[model samples]
Each structure stands twice: as C-alpha cells, then as structure tokens.
Target: MRLVAAAVTFGAVLATLSGCGSDGPSGPVDAGGAQGRRAPGVTALPATDPTLIPDVGERLQRRIPADTGQVLVVYGEGENSPDSTAVFYMKEGPEWQRVARWAAHNGRKGWTVEHYSGDDRSPVGVFGLTDAGGVLDDPGSRLPYDQDYVAYAPTVNAVAYDHVFDYVIAIDYNRLPGTVPHNPTRPLGEDRGGGIWLHLDHGDGTSGCVSLPKGAMKFLLRTLDPAQHPVMVMGDERELRA
Candidate 1:
C-alpha cells in the first residue's frame, strides 16, 4: 500500500510540475512587510549574534508572546516564493540568541493569513509548537512522539514524501494540542486549514508546510523543549518585521 501510494504521489507531483494543472500553489507574488509592529517591553538587541540573517530578532521581539522563550523563525524570501530559512532561537538574559540555522522551504505560493486546505500557501503569524511524530523511532524528543505510518502518510509526491516524516514537529495551527500530531481532527473546520508542520525536506517545495533537511529535523526534535513554551514565528521577511 505504501508503495502504491508513493507511485501515485510521484506521478501527481511530476504532472503538477509539468503544468498539468492540479490546483497547486500558484498565487500572486508576495508583497511582504504587511505586518510589523515591535511589541512592548522588548529592548536591547542581542550582544552575540550567531547567524547572519538580518532583522529577525527585532521582528520577533514584536511578534512573539512575552512568555515564549523558544522560537523557530521560518523566514521566507518572499510571499510567493518556495524557498526560506529556518532559525531556532532561545531567549537569553534580555534578547534572543540564535541556536541553529538551516535552509528550508515553504509553500509553493508563499504565505497567507486566510489559508485553506490545498491552497499551497502557508499561514502567517505566530503559532505554538506542540505534538510531534515521525516514521522513525523517537529521537529523545521532549514532546509526545508518534511513530506510526498512519501518522506519517505520504500524501504528496511519494519521492517528496519519502522520509519526509522521518521527523516532524506539528505546528498548532487548527488542531488540538497534546494529541498525536497525525490526528485529523481540525478545530477550525477542514477547509479553514490544518496539519501545518515542520518536517524533513525533499529538496522541493511543499504543498503548504515547512520543510527542512532530515538532519535539521532531527536536531529540532531533540532541541524543542515543551517547558520553554516553543512557538513558530513564520512569514515573509517584511511581514515578519511588521
């Protein structure tokens, strides 16, 4: 059954790439910086910056909740671009510190607040990080982990989905927390969107989820601590600053 699914998905992905028209992510070019406002009480940028990415610390200070100490910023190159950069940060004494960085990919069409299922656009804004699971065994993750094929189905191109679920961090978009990340129960209605996750990259754009290299996925799984109240601040460069 898995093989059959993979075959089907691969063909579909190829056809989509060839412009066969399956309603893939093909939205307008993004006009970033749509949402930026520094939050209160955040001052003094970090003294020691680890990564070369610009303005993310300042933008996150205004976006993330005060209580959030751990953040995964998925900064996209543009609103409609598939490429992005993922950086993990931990709050230091007064500012955030970059712990890790990796090349990542977002939805085919970029980002949108009014995301829907099969829209090919990732949702913008801050969201809490909760449950996680994958096709492989647990990797010392702090959060609950499910290692079932059902939880990690290869719905996309089988090649792309291959090992994509080897590790996954479920973003609390429209689903209930504490449950298995694969739970199909979407709180915001199925159409409103659900199942947005950070998973292993396949070297291609995802339907509407963020993808990182397998190594990075494993690193994230091992590093994300639930006690720190980890959350994701994702969006185009400009909007993230806003």
Candidate 2:
C-alpha cells in the first residue's frame, strides 16, 4: 500500500538526503590512534567457533538477540571513510554461516555512536531489520513491503539518486518497529535522528543509509526471513571490532 501523501513529501525526501527522513557518523581516522585499534575490554568470539563473525567484538556481539538467526554486517573501511563491505550471515544449527557478501557504502562522513540530524553518518550499533519498501514492486521480501513511488522518490539530485530507493530494508534505529520505512515517527525524539535503511547503492556514499548493489538488495529482499529475526550490525571496522 502507498504511504499517506501527507506523511511522505518532497520535503521528507530532502530531509533524508541530508540524513534525516527515512534513510539516514563520526570523524577522521587516526592511523596510529585508538580509531585504528580494536576497542579494549571487548572480547570477540573465538575464530575457531563457527558462529564467529570476524571483527565483531563483545559489546556489539552481545547486542545481537539470541533468537536472531540472520545478521548483516556493514564493515566500514575507516572512521572517516565512506567505503564499506556488507556480509550476510545466517545461523545454521549452532553455527552462523556466511550466505553472501557485497561491496557497499555508508554515510558520506562515516559512522558514529551518537548520530544526530544532518550528521551524514550512519549509526554504530546493532539494529533490527523489520521493514521493507521502495518505489518498485515487492520482490518477494519476507518483511512487510510498502510500495509508493511518490513517497519514495528523491527530491534532490534526482539524477544521482535515481533508482536508489527501488528497494529498501528499514534499519530499526530510533524508528518504530513494524512500520513503513518512510514513517516519520521517532520515539527517541527527532534530535536523535532516524530513517536509516539498507538501500540500492548509487555508486557512492549515502547521507546516512547503507547502500548496496541492486543485485545484493534484491538478494537480501528475497532471502532475509522474518522467522530468522534479522539484525544489522554496522560501524567502522575498528568500532565493530570493539
């Protein structure tokens, strides 16, 4: 179904372009500084363990709900780099298995623990993947899919953002779960920011959303199962390792 016209507007699309609306980090990296090293006091799963997700540390690792059987990791190249890689894993029996991996992009400025409006940084945390939508028709997603071309259209840099919203999976960060990806409700209050999603890559960094290739987006839409309780773990590699 289409989103209410009043709820989805060109202004909202603009807000998203600036890292606000439905699709929503930090600073420069210090090669020899803390940003370059794994966070202290955070233990990671043993590599020998089949469930181990490389580089994910104890802090974020513990945040993955025990019941969650699916995880998508967005590994950023650096604290200030927009480049990233995405890996999808599915729990198989007692072990997690890699199902797919794709090159991806994050916020133009990178990642952050405290994301705010217009920060142009994706949040660093583990968030549930609960909703899907886009300008295109549903691609057999297991999550609730909202299709509304007008609501999902880009209002700024139309040429550059063309088809970016053809598919999207809502990353539950500061947004109400089980709602449309474009829902403007922010339970954390507007200042905390919201609207972050996993969408089709436009060949560059996003304002805040994580962008992936169209093929990958379609793969995820068709494979991510609600019964698996998917969650996305994202941040710069070092932060994720912490």
Candidate 3:
C-alpha cells in the first residue's frame, strides 16, 4: 500500500531532495508494462525513501553497515509487529533506496506507548513529518540543568534519567495526563511525551519514542525535508519488540 507522507512543509530548508521534483515520473504503468526512466542523480522509486532499519533483512545484521534515512516503511493495518513492517533509509549515494530493516516495538496490550509517563508499548498509526530535538544540546529551562536535549517534542516529558538517543517523538496512541495522549495530526507536547523526540538507546530504551541506533536517528532527523509532510507507518502485535 502507498504511504500518506507527513504534515510539515518547508520549501526553503536547503534540502538535497529529489523524489518530490515535478519532472519526476509517477502514476501506474502502461498496458505494455514499460520500465520507469530513472532520474539522473535520483533513481526511479515506488514512492518513499529506502534506508530505514526495519526495511533491511532478518535478524539484527543491519547495524554493522549502518545506513538509514530517506526510508520506506513497509506496513499496514492488522498488527504492528517488527516483521509486520519494513523500514527503509538512504544508502549508497543521493538516491533514496531500501537497505536496512527492523521489527518495530508496537503497543503490547492494555498499556499504550507514551513518552512522558505511561505504559511502554509503541503507538499504532500513521504519523506526520515531525520535528527533532536533542536533550544533549538543548537550551531549555526544565531538565537536569546540566542535561541537554534534542527531541521531536519542542516541549514535553519532565523526567530526566536518560533513555537512549538525544531525542524522542511522542507516539500518538495513549491516554496520558499532561500530553495530547494518542491522537493523530496533533502538535507535540499535546499531552506529555510531547517532548518525545527520536534519540539513541541508553539501555532502558524508550518510554514511547522510536528507539533506533544513534547514527540512524541522526540521519533521519536531518534527511527529513523540513518542508514536506513525511509519514510514519506503525502498529504492533505478537512477535513485535521481541
């Protein structure tokens, strides 16, 4: 199925974008079944980037080469298990193609995936192109005073024990207090994990934010077109997060 992209839209982000160009080819193939003409610097695609972890192969062998961003997340309704999805990121060169993959951490059962303070189970739905923050180089007033940050949520999550990356994005699929809970298309910090941005895995991993390798997360945060509306495909079931 075709993904729906994200919400943000910035045309002057000094981005090295291609898949969004007008001259690019699109639509269904002809009855004769002709091949697509690949772009000069950019290769022909089926929509969406290709380099995310979940888009790789079996096991955790994708960590070695380390190449994600401009990803193509392969998922659907039913369940949001790790294998249930295939996340692709950028690799090789400027061409956005699939490389790595992963089995996402979707919601478990009763508990929802929140960043602030709630049960630990990833959310389930399609997210828009969100922002990125870093607790490592943040200039905020809350936090441990000494702790910096860079997360998806410009303002949310009050705890400061450290999880993984320098950021965290609130997964919309929960019932928290200070946060927007789990609603689609809402801005950050709506509820609590609003401060949730993508970050590295510390050990305890995540509260709700998507936890990936530091390098992967960094590439994604930067690769995202600050002007385009990128989409996040997520869901979970049995073999997820295992």
Candidate 2 clashing pairs, residues 3+ apart or interchain? 22-195, 24-208, 24-209, 25-111, 25-121
Off-target runs (Cα >4 Å) in candidate 1 are 1-63
Candidates ranked, most accurate by TM-score first: 2, 1, 3
* Regions of candidate 2 where Cα sits further than 4 Å from its true position: 1-46
Which one wins on TM-score?
2
lDDT per residue, candidate 1, 1-242, as tens digits? 53354344333423332221122221111111111322111122433454222355465556567666678878788888887877666655445555555667899888887889999999987888988998889977878899897658777666756778888889888999988887889988999888899988787678889987665666567656776678988888777766
State the lDDT of candidate 2 residue by residue for 1-242, as single tens digits.
Answer: 12233223222322322221122110111211122323222223335567666678899989999878778888888888888877667665556655556667899999999999899999999999989999999977889999999889975666868888999999999999999999999999999888899988777788899997676676677667686688999999789978
Q: Which stretches of candidate 3 lie over 4 Å from their true place?
A: 1-86, 89-117, 138-165, 169-196, 203-205, 237-242
Q: Give the TM-scores of the predictions, in the order they appear.
A: 0.75, 0.80, 0.41
Q: What lDDT, from 0 to 1, does candidate 3 have?
A: 0.34
Give lDDT tens digits, candidate 3, residues 89-165: 33333344343332232222212334344554445444444434455453231211223343223333445434443
lDDT for predicted candidate 1 compared with the true structure: 0.69
- Candidate no. 3 TM-score: 0.41
Tell me the whole-model lDDT of each prediction, alpha carbons only: 0.69, 0.75, 0.34
Summing lDDT over every window of 10 consecutive residues in candidate 1, give the lowest-scoring window. Answer: 26-35
Q: What's the lDDT for residue 88 in model 1?
A: 64
